[model samples]
Target: MPVSRRDFLKMAGLGLVGSGLPATPLKQIARNVTTDNAASMLYDATKCVGCRACQVACKQRSGLPAEPDAQGLYETPRDLSANTWTMIKLAKENSEISFVKNQCMHCLEPACVSVCPVVALEKLESGPVIYHPERCIGCRYCMAACPFGIPKSQWEENLPLIQKCDFCADRLAKGEAPACGEACPTGALIYGTRGEMLGKAHARLASDKNYIQDVYGESEVGGTSMLYIAGVGFDALGFPRLKDDPLTAITWPYMKAVPAVIAVMASLSTAIYFRTHRDKGKQNGEEASDGSKD
Candidate 1:
């Protein structure tokens, strides 16, 4: 059966590679202890009203220009873009409505961090996935690797840069919440430690039996700093149904192994060709010597 785009997105969200392999362990390295802690966000779609105030706040905080619509009115973006770091998507199933906020998932084992050939993206000690434009060569590989499609490029600019949510690292350092969380009128977006957020997500799922039993990000892509609680299946909200394993994990081993296999084949081919030519040369030389003697 052909996988639909919606289904593909779900798989992407779950960190499933296109190859359909099971989830694998993400590479994680421990960092030195510091007083500063990792920060995260918890998004409850059931509680979101899609007011888009959070979107406005994000633009204001990030100093991004307003997105104008056909009517020249400021409109919230439907997806994450260079000028829009956060977005809200609406989903409906069986007459039930859900609002899903979209942004960088900030994976515990971030594929972007692992795939960046130039180390443009880094998983910071504070848990936010930060992008260093200075190191970026505009490859946009991070955008391709991200399950959530969170990273954006300034395509219009001559010198493009990858853009995504930083979990408000600057604000967090000053003991401030992310603009989106602070702007959420219904407390739909909450900022805190991953542990605390996971606990809260589980509690919500437990208390609200109707909610999807799965916590979108708990183990997806080896987990994400931003979590979600959805009333409808995540698919309806544009969240891809990903395999438990990250896409990067599923694809990397094959990529790494190909070169070694090619090298071995090349070596064998070279040896065979050389041996054949050497034998022919020896036969020709011996025939010439015999002819000369005769």
Candidate 2:
């Protein structure tokens, strides 16, 4: 009474059937939210004066603590972190200098939202990619999936949570602008509908001779809620050069195969366990029979 190759195949098939993977492949699932009236932000790099008003406003609105330097004299963070949601980075190319505003791009088809196993990250129809701490399993997949490297984990805590800009979804719901945009004294940061922002970005590109020809986020990674226009090349301003295709194209195939692979492995493991124990039991019975004859 040994298990045959046919029996093994049957077991594998049953495991696949019981895995409960969705009927629709992950690639087929809708990734892009309707963005016609979605909340969006536009940053004009030429207008930014490196005042850091937006950074301060962001911290105040989010109730985040300040990060002090080695001397503990002042809060000057070099990059985004759990406490620092956004920051102004100064990039210098020869004598010319440009202040780059760095934060979550909040892509139309967010890779972070796509990769989260627990649905802890969600892309709202209004354009913010918000995080749900209660639903989070602290997987940190969203941090890795983001092309902009926006999400930061609170590593100090026993149970750390991911943190990043949510485009001020609460403010958007209240029909108010984001704190960062509202705090900009130079009118560098503009908040409006995605359509309106795109229009303004395009208009500036056409009207201003000094501004770069390209709109940074209009088509990058299938577009983003946050857009930028700069006087110098974006590369000089420390912007990542990304393709127009959505990141979901790259992640979906691997995600889709996970369940099937798990099922096959489970079935093989089960079959091995049963076969090993069955052989041991049969050998024990044979020894008992021989003893009776003696």
Candidate 3:
């Protein structure tokens, strides 16, 4: 039997029931790790001189290869990729230029962690979004779920994997700061506890009238480990103005009804099957009566 458009949509919505993620937004499932003791990174655009030392340090520490542009002599990359975990993205507004460091936000309630079918992506208690490639099936669902678009796939490799900055989990475990934080000479990138970083970000904004009133990443997507304090507008600096609520909360209600959706689809499928069978039986009966009458 042919399926109607409405039935197709019902089946599609039903697929969410077995999608490996919870239907309801379980409070403690992914949100148990709070920022109270979590390590965090703070980027102050006002203090950044755009030296790109942090960029070099990320490659050196991770042992990732450099990605040169069309002119192979330059290692300048426009955005995050498989090789470049972190890069200084330039934001231009006429003559004045601002530098924004793009990396994993490491969200407190990370959407990647919530959506990963294989549990490959995890949010550490130390405030880093780490990936386990061995567990990863290269699904790329994490890439779609992430609001910051931080994860990059190693598409060129024979045995490819997705890569992103883990906030230097190795260094953090050893009680040292991340390579990018260590390499920042102007104190632009600071590594510390999440609470302490938030305090500093707020303090700078309060002390300096020149700084923008808003603190990027403080409450974006229910807050992130990485925070930003910039003098220029966040939009002008290419920062996305996002709602404070986690994406999970926004979509969970519909997700919770997936079973019902699936039930409706199953019933519809059965109805279609029986109806076609009945119609075929009636046609056979009509043909037999006509032959008997002749």
Candidate 4:
């Protein structure tokens, strides 16, 4: 009536052996309407004057409310928040000051898109990572997945949504640039195709020997639509130390394996339940046969 270790091993083998096959290649869903053209934003920190006008512009365009101070004054946020989709953070090093605008990097292979269980975060062909709140179950998995910590949650409301910069997708649909790009006065933030932006970033670095040799986001997290050129080191400008691999590439294999693991677990559980029940039934039938013989 007792099951041996070998039986357990055999059952486990039946449940899991040959079940560790690789996942099928994910279907290539066209993310953007325009395949040939990719939307991108270029941020040259050397030219940024720390005006924070883009932050204001984002709020104005998005219909977001201004954050109020204790004194009820409308003070601009120092970091991206639920109310502020974009912000300018100040960094000082070697007696020099630079303003680093913080917003969504919008990676070509976005981790958020890979990790979202409900398909709430989507990578658009227009090169923005957009969040659909109606589909969101208010889980903050996207926040944990993002290397830049871009997506913020609106915790004040009973029903909240994950908020982040969408690269102004609506404006792009109307053939207009994003509000942040339009608000940048010194041409620090430029909007163009990803290929063109990379070229410009390299040209600026080459022209000015004073500029940092590296272009942030060109290769970081498997390339981002939003690129940055800084006079100072990128670390001084609050750029995260990201892996060279695409964020999604680092996470997708594990995510894809989860369903298989779940299926195996379910099958093993059912097998164990039926085996136990069948043994119990046999024991009961044997006891009744013995009583009849007596």
Give the per-residue lDDT of model 1 (tens digit) for 121-163. 8988778888888899999988887878889999999998988
Order by TM-score, highest first? 4, 1, 3, 2
Candidate 3 local lDDT, 57-88, one digit each (tens): 99999999898879799998878998999889
lDDT of 2 at 215: 89
Model 4, residue pairs in steric clash: 31-125, 32-125
CA error at residue 164 for candidate 2, angstroms: 0.6
Task: Tell me the TM-score of model 4.
Answer: 0.78
Q: What lDDT score is found at residue 60 in candidate 4?
A: 91
Model 1's alpha-carbon lDDT is 0.79
Best by TM-score: 4
What ranges in model 4 sit over 4 Å off? 1-36, 258-294
Cα lDDT of model 4 by residue, 1-294, tens digit: 143433444555565644333223333333342522689989999899988889889989999998877787767575788888888888887888888888998888888888889999898877778888789997799899788888889989888899999889989988899999999999999999887888899999999998889989877767788999988888888888775556564356567789877998999999998887887977788789778755
- Name the lDDT of candidate 4: 0.81
The CA root-mean-square deviation of candidate 3, after full C-alpha superposition on the true structure, stands at: 7.4
Candidate 2 Cα errors over 4 Å, as ranges: 1-33, 254-294
The lDDT of each candidate is 0.79, 0.86, 0.83, 0.81
Clashes counted in candidate 2 amount to: 0
Clashes of each: 9, 0, 0, 2
